[model samples]
Target: MCIIFFHFNPNSASAYRLILAANRDEFYSRPSKPADFWANNGNILSGLDMEKGREGGTWLGISKKGKCAALTNYLQPVINMDALGRGYLVPNFLTQDMDGLTYLKKISLEGHLYNGFNLLTVDFSNTKGDMMCYYGNRSDQEPRVLDPGIYGLCNSLLDTPWKKLVNGKKLFTETIKKSCALSPENLTQELLNMLNNEEYQLPVTDIEEQGQDFIRPILEEFSALFIRTSFYGTRTNTVILVDAKGHVTFTERCLLKPDTNQWKVSSYQFELET
Candidate 1:
């Protein structure tokens, strides 16, 4: 499962803020267009072109309106055919005008035929921005809303408190609650702290703790031998921020190669007319 955290603050230049950190075994598939999967003429928007038959997943992106979104895959037991590809949700949220509840209800009915996945979409373009969560039917409940601040979202549930996303939550909470002042520059520093933290250590103490405990076991079990696979490991850690003014910044980290320590950072900043 992957993890996503976002901040919604209307007073800042960018009405919304977002940070996405995800850990996957690797992606070994072809590429596809956002529209080929679904159409999102809505408020939020984001997409990644699948490299022909090579598949890739996106963290999240914003739209011309004041919307933002992210998604994660569920790694639980289920029929293979039951899983629904969520490549369309990001772009849908970015481009669609549908608010939280409206989109939830519509997607619920549309997803009845599919299996596992989760999407978190937020729109602050209205008088007050709102947030919502959508899960495959087996989650035992209906879609729900999220509060403003840092949150941990994984495949299992909202704020799953898993290893990869826990430390980020802690840092974000402290920055907002304890800092005397906050700004885009400070937020970017906090993000870098998480990415540069010991990549080889355990993320948490135990299953009950809000961190990762099975670090050793997972590495031992999976890194037994080196094999050639057309997979992209941890490509980049992205950080996005949208203050009240509709300004946004996107930063990405490009790793050297598999099992390497070097990395490169690239950033993009833009503003919307909202």
Candidate 2:
């Protein structure tokens, strides 16, 4: 949602990997983690509250069934609803092992009576591998199969104009390019370098859009402010995938937290050796 990080082809043994960390005041009102969570979901999974019988704030989730998904709220005010439309997506993804596209089709056809929201679903269960983001509103923009590079998508449409999304993406892209130019051997470190670069150091901004001043209270809650100054927006999200040998890794960091430098909140390391 606010912060999204990933690597398309990192030249590793894993096929794909992703880690998601997000912050939201809305999660407080929702339910907590699921009971017998391991039985239904994978060994690694995370989520917040929002569903009818479930909670929200799903930073990241990975199922033993090989299904994975991470959720974040986009920073937009015009797309408001009583509840995030189909807010139950995260829990459903964790508990149910359905094909990604099949699931998306059903949700798209069935309308919702709640607030509008966006979702990124990853399905690697079969050869039909893909990643998708949805806007539960009039926008018919279907999910996008993520490319093999560093990408950031907040709430304002994929590849928006927000400083973090825009600038972050630039740094992320250049980091990878420069690394490739040096030598392909630094693939791992190169990928990490992109996620760990310091040149992206710029004080956060309280970026206000065309006509959302009145909604400052809501916007301020999730906009990017310097980690040292605020915790309203996405700190950082990193993902890496290598298909040649079937290995993957992903990590997300809470940049606002002063006490921790360990980023990979939710991660998966495995080989789909079928």
Candidate 3:
């Protein structure tokens, strides 16, 4: 996932506990399967990254056991192509029985083995209560439980206040506040529409402002929520809503034909098995 905007309100007396929308940006040539129940692990509901060496991994996913995870790469000039595929982090958490904190601690030890990335893990099955933890290998901050509130994550640390993240968060917060009276389907559509935003602005930091000469143009090209290029762009838009009563709704819109605007949408609804 390149960009994510979410509201985590576990203490809310409202109908929903979590509301999330994310866009997965990648090369159009990278093969991927749309969101579906994995055949190897029926408990997992997520789209598969079919790229060679990264098969079976996902950018975001949820398990029937009430575990959810999402990952975003940390933007930098250098990437270790030989490093472990960060995409596997999501499925590794969802498929395990470990609590979010334990799993994060374990991963933190080997975090250096992979490219820099940010991970968000949630364990709704916790006996104490649902907990969300954010950890980034490139960050000095330890994996800590997040307080209930709105959050945004992109190609940086959590809530980094990047130009895109700042604007996206504002729009997301507004849509969420107005969604109190909307049905699940309508809310999902509204979030999807928000992901289609294509506005761009200057980078928020000097580091972000200075991109590698080779990829600098590509970097600036994706400053918007929705990015489109001949070879690379946002491949999918995903929206997930988990209600206070444990009802879950997951929807994904995948670009069927890149550069042609053709899209295929898949949706699933189920109750958390906690």
Give the winner by lDDT. 3
Segments of candidate 1 deviating more than 4 angstroms: 10-25, 28-57, 77-83, 126-138, 178-183, 196-232, 259-262
lDDT for each residue of candidate 3 in 1-274, tens digit (9 for 90 to 100) = 3899989877345667889999999888999999999898888899999998889889999988899999998877777879998999999999888988889989999999998899999877524678889999998777889999999998878998778788899999999888889999999999999999988756635325533553576666677899888899998999999988788999999999985789999999998887
Q: Considering lDDT, where higher is better, how would the candidates rank from best to worst?
A: 3, 1, 2
Greater TM-score among 1 and 3 belongs to 3
Give the per-residue lDDT of model 1 (tens digit) for 25-133: 2343434223111243443334364654324445466665656667766544334654455656666556666786678667777765554567777665534544544
Structural similarity to truth (TM-score) of each candidate: 0.70, 0.62, 0.95
In angstroms, the error of model 3 at 70 is 0.2
Report clashes for each candidate as comma-separated counts.
Answer: 35, 26, 0
Model 3: residues with Cα > 4 Å off, grouped in runs = 203-207
Residue 271 lDDT in candidate 1: 71
Runs with alpha carbons beyond 4 Å of true place in candidate 2: 7-40, 47-57, 78-87, 125-138, 142-150, 178-207, 210-243, 252-268
Q: What is the lDDT, from 0 to 100, of the residue 178 in candidate 3?
A: 84
Residues forming the 10-long window of minimal summed lDDT in candidate 3 = 206-215
| Error of model 1, residue 260, in angstroms | 4.7
